[model samples]
Target: MKIAFIGTGLMGYPMAKNLLEKNLELNVFSRTIEKAKPLEKFAAKISNSLSEAVKGVDVVITMLTDDDAVEKVLSDQDFQENLKKGSTIVDMSSIKPKIAIKYGKLLKDQGINFLDAPVSGGTIGAEQATLAIMVGGDQKVFDQIKDVLKVMGNPTLVGPIGSGQVSKLANQIIVGITIGAVAEAITLCEKAGVDGNKFIKALAGGFADGKILQNHGKRMIDKDFSPKGKVSTHLKDMNNILECAGDLNTQLPISNLIKDMFKSLVENGNDNDDHSALYKEIERRNKN
Candidate 1:
């Protein structure tokens, strides 16, 4: 199937390449053309305009940053006026489920199909094509795109429109809290004269062990705060979660607490650092 891929950032770059490798007729665009250049060598055509990229494509996938970026890109005249009827828009950007729902209905009205399919697994997963994709949209549409989606990751139809984002929010909550737990545990252990790196080894295979403990935990011990997922980005997801929770009259005290911690990291100029850098905030707290 013909495809248009937008937002060629860290994750988007590799993802577009995966599609190109699959011999798909792929068109690509990024707000910054330089980011889109790399895909050209992989036989992916770079479109100078959003409409040019999306026009006549069977599937248009957006892997943008957040709600605002996604809105800004999708609301463009090129996207609005040019996308042909019956084509599908697969938004892989993390956004509010309600926003996803809002746009889904709007797209449906215009004879377009929209799927709110957010993902996990960070850049590593994107590059490896093992990311877990949670999709929310028509079952029929999902079935049609299942093979295409599988090229990127494991795609699961969570529910009707917006469920993918809801699933992502739940994912961020667990990830944020687990990072908090690992960070605090490491800090406390180090302060009490234990080796933080060895601590992780000791905890391996236990209930406290999981992917976070292995990957993010190692990052914490090594002070490797590079961005797999930025703290600011996680903060955005947390806010989305709290907002969703508010609409449902749900209380999320821990999520709120972790949200504040991430906010502090952003305010202190760690916004672009890895979310695991939440360790920096906890370390600061212990010192004071």
Candidate 2:
């Protein structure tokens, strides 16, 4: 199938590369041409313009930074005009549920299918093709594109349009809280003269054990804050979560606290560091 991929940044670059490896007819576009140039070596057609990239493609996949970036692309007249009728647009960015639903309705009116298929799993997962893709769209459409998605990750059709983003928000909430919990526990143990590594090992195979505790806990222990998922990105997710909650007339107290922690990190210029750097924030709090 002919496909167009936009936003070839950190996560997007690897995802588009996986599609190219499958020998699909792929056109890749990035506002920054350098990012798309590498994919050309993989036999991807690099488009000079967004319209040029999308024209006549059966599907267009976007893995952008945030809702604003996604909206800027989707709202472009050139982008809308270039999309062929009956084509599908799968947005794999973590964005607001309301925005997803908004675009879903707008695109549906034009006979185009839109799916909010946000993902979880950092850059490593993107490179390894093990990302947990949560999809929200028509079942039939999902089935039609399932194979293409599977090239990058395991895609699940959770419900209708916007559900994928909701699921991602839930995932982020759990992630933020768990990171905080792990950091706090690890810090407490360290303060009490306990070995953080051994402490985590003690919790292994117990209910507290999870991907976050194991993977992120390891990052904490090693002081490796390189960006698997950036602190800024998680901050954006937290803001989106609270915005969504406010729209639904609900409260997320723990998420709010986590949001502030992320905000503090970003304010202190840790925006580009890994989200696991939240541990550093907790570590700072215990410094007395």
Candidate 3:
């Protein structure tokens, strides 16, 4: 099957490469043509225009940064018309569930299938094809494309229509709180003069151990501010969480605290750094 991939950024590039490596017919598009060049060795056709990239493709997969970019590509008249009936649009970006439902209905009316298939696991997960995918769509559609989803990650059909996005929002909430907890725990350890590395080792089999502690915990100890997942992205997810909670008339005290922490980091000009930089922010606050 021919697949068209849009937004070949950090996550998308590796995803599209995995699909191409599986020998699927692939067409790639990026806002900047340069970003699309790296995938040329996969022998897929590259297009500068969304219209050209999606035309005649059986599946259109989007891994953009936000809902606005997704809307921009989908609302392109040429792209809208070129997407054939029965074709599926898999949106892997983390966006609001309400927005996902609206777009899914719009595409359904046009005889196109839309799935809010948001993913977890960072760039490393995408590169390794081990990302966890939460899908929201018709069961039959998901069953049909299960193999395709597997090419990128282990995908689970969460529910119908907007369920995947809801699951993703939940995932973000857990990640936000976990990373924050990891940051605080490491900071406390450092202040107490305990070896952070040894702490991680001793806690490996305990309740304190988790993917967040292992992956981001190491970054905390070494003070690596490199962007695996940027502070801005987490802030965006926090905003979404707050908005979603308000709509549900629910309270998220812990997420609220994490949001404030991230806001402080962003306000202090660490928006482009990894979320693990929260440790540094905590250290800075302590020093002052």
Candidate 4:
């Protein structure tokens, strides 16, 4: 089946590569054409415009950063008319669930299938083709593209329309809490003069051995503030959580705490850094 992949950033790059390697006919579109150049060697066509990328494609997959970018691409006049009827648009970005539902309805009106399939597992997972995908869409449509979804990652149909983004928000909440806990624990260990590396090793097999501790823990120990997952990304996710919570009138104290912690990290010059840089923020607070 022909596929169009939009946004070739850190996660998008590898996810698109996975699709190409799976031998699917692939076309790539990115804000920068150079970003799409690497995929050209894999027999993937590179489109300079969104219209060119999406035109005549059987499926268009968008892995952009936020909802606005997704909306811009989808609402483009060229994209709206050129995208064939019966084709599906899979959005893997983590955005508001209500936004997903709105877009789903809009696409359905055009006889196009829309699926909100936000992903987790970070850049490493994307590169490894092991990201966990949470999908919200029609069961029949999901079944039709299940094979292609599998090529990118393990896809689970969470519910019908908007459920995927809701699941993604849940994922962000858990990730925020876990990362915050890991940061606090590491900070305490540092204050007590315990070797953070050794402490992590001691807790390797215990209940503390989560992905955040295993992956972000190492980055924290090394003081690597590189962007595996940017603090801004988590900040956006936290905003979505807060908005969703407000919409449902639900109380989420833990999520609220983590959101503030992320805000602190961003204020401390770690906005573009890795989310694991929260450890540095915790350490800074301890020193003060």
lDDT of each: 0.93, 0.94, 0.91, 0.91
Candidate 2, residue 10: the lDDT equals 88
Error of 3 at 105 (Å): 0.5
Any runs in candidate 4 off by more than 4 Å, and if so which?
none
Cα RMSD, model 2: 1.1
- Cα lDDT tens digits, model 3, 59-83, are 9999999879888887789999889
Worst 10 residues of 3 by lDDT: 278-287
Q: Is candidate 2 or candidate 3 better by lDDT?
A: 2
In model 4, state the lDDT of residue 74: 78
Q: Pick by lDDT: which candidate is best?
A: 2
Task: Residues 59-142, candidate 2: write the lDDT tens digits.
Answer: 999999998999999999999999999999999999999999999999999999999999998888999999999999999999
Higher TM-score: candidate 2 or 3?
3
Report the candidate with higher TM-score, 2 versus 4.
4
Question: Could you tell me how far off, in angstroms, the CA of residue 253 lies in candidate 4 after the best superposition?
Answer: 0.9
- Model 1, C-alpha of 4: deviation from truth (Å): 0.2
| Reference-based lDDT, residue 179, model 2 | 92
Residue 93 Cα positional deviation in candidate 3, in Å, after optimal superposition: 0.5
- 1 against 3, candidate with superior lDDT: 1
